[model samples]
Target: MSDLVYEILQLAGILAFAISGALVGVRRRLDLLGVVVVGAFTGVGGGIVRDMLLGVHPPVSFVHWPNLAVAIGGSLVVFFVHPGITRIRHFEVVFDAFGLGLFSANGAATALEAGQTPLTAILVGTITAIGGGVIRDVLVNTVPGVLTRELYAVSALFGAGIAVGIEGLGGDAWLASIVGGAAAIVLRLTSVARGWHLPKPRFTDERAATQE
Candidate 1:
């Protein structure tokens, strides 16, 4: 994960998250401008938050033309040519998974570059991965998937931790990002495919008891 590679991954993540937001916008029947706005926020909102937390006055995404361009391009592509409405949810999840992994690792790399501690880097990574999605969902008036979706935040946390661990073990940020992002993506997709998730408390059925 050289600088070039990390940049590429960041672009990919931007595109993926933009696509996620665009899909949701389309499903929600928003207009073109609305869809684009949603997509842009989804692509860069997390990075903006991360920068703010790190005390970077001017967020990188705000000044980066390429980031805005990629986000808009992804939105246009999805708006113009995408799956049927019924398939939007599936595609949204796919793209969101990709974004989640790359952004998580990217966040860790950025934090490390800023000389943050391992714990802070990892936490920032997880926040960067999920913050955009959370915003996207809120804008669309839906529950954030990270709260209820199968193994969402856990995957991000694991990915960030892996990246930090790699860096701590004498690996460069690039290698850590690549490995950690891949780990997150694999775990997320696998959890979706296999219905793996954290355990939830089950309550006995009050209706059954009343009936008995």
Candidate 2:
């Protein structure tokens, strides 16, 4: 795809992700400032980290005013509008899944553009997809979705891996992103619909007592 389209996709994905993060802040009853902070963090935290690791000085967030603007703007809208765009019964979960898929694709692409190996690209992509949510959960005093749900990280990993695989196969970057995003979205949606979960380690009464 053209650079123009890629840039647009990147921005749109970031804005969508920011809105989801802001919703989380709203659900937690945070103030407007907190909403903006969480939204911006969620939108750009992973990309920033990935760029830093890849030695992309300043990262796109610093160089691109629109990226920051969209994030903050999305947060503002979410703060004042609440769930402005949806009346779905599971709007939060749906949007969170959308953001996860979007960011996973974007992150993986960014890693490859930075000349990272396929494995590293996928890892960076996974981090990019989940890092913001992790930070948001930490701020809100809850375990991240990935820590509690096996499917969350797995979904991201699948998407990132697909992106890396496609790029390695010499496919178009945009096409690769779509494939990766679809894989992530399908995995997450399926898991949610099916109530799939990773098992937690079992502890016997004796084991618990011994630990205590």
Candidate maximizing lDDT: 1
Q: What is the Cα-based lDDT of residue 67 in candidate 1?
A: 86
lDDT of 2 by residue, 54-81 (tens): 7889888999888888889988988887
Candidate 2, backbone clash total = 0
Worst 10 residues of 1 by lDDT: 203-212
Reference-based lDDT, residue 184, model 1: 95
Q: Write the per-residue lDDT of candidate 1 for residues 1-212, one digit (tens) a residue.
A: 47688779889988999999999899898989989989989998888888998999898888889988999999988888865456678888899999999989888977987899999999999999998899999999989989988899999998999999999999988888888999999999999999998987564985664563
Candidate 1 lDDT at 62 equals: 83
Candidate 2 residue spans exceeding 4 A from truth: 83-89, 206-212
Q: TM-score each candidate.
A: 0.92, 0.89
lDDT for 118 in candidate 2 is 85
- Candidate 1 collision pairs: none
Tell me the lDDT of model 1 at 2.
76
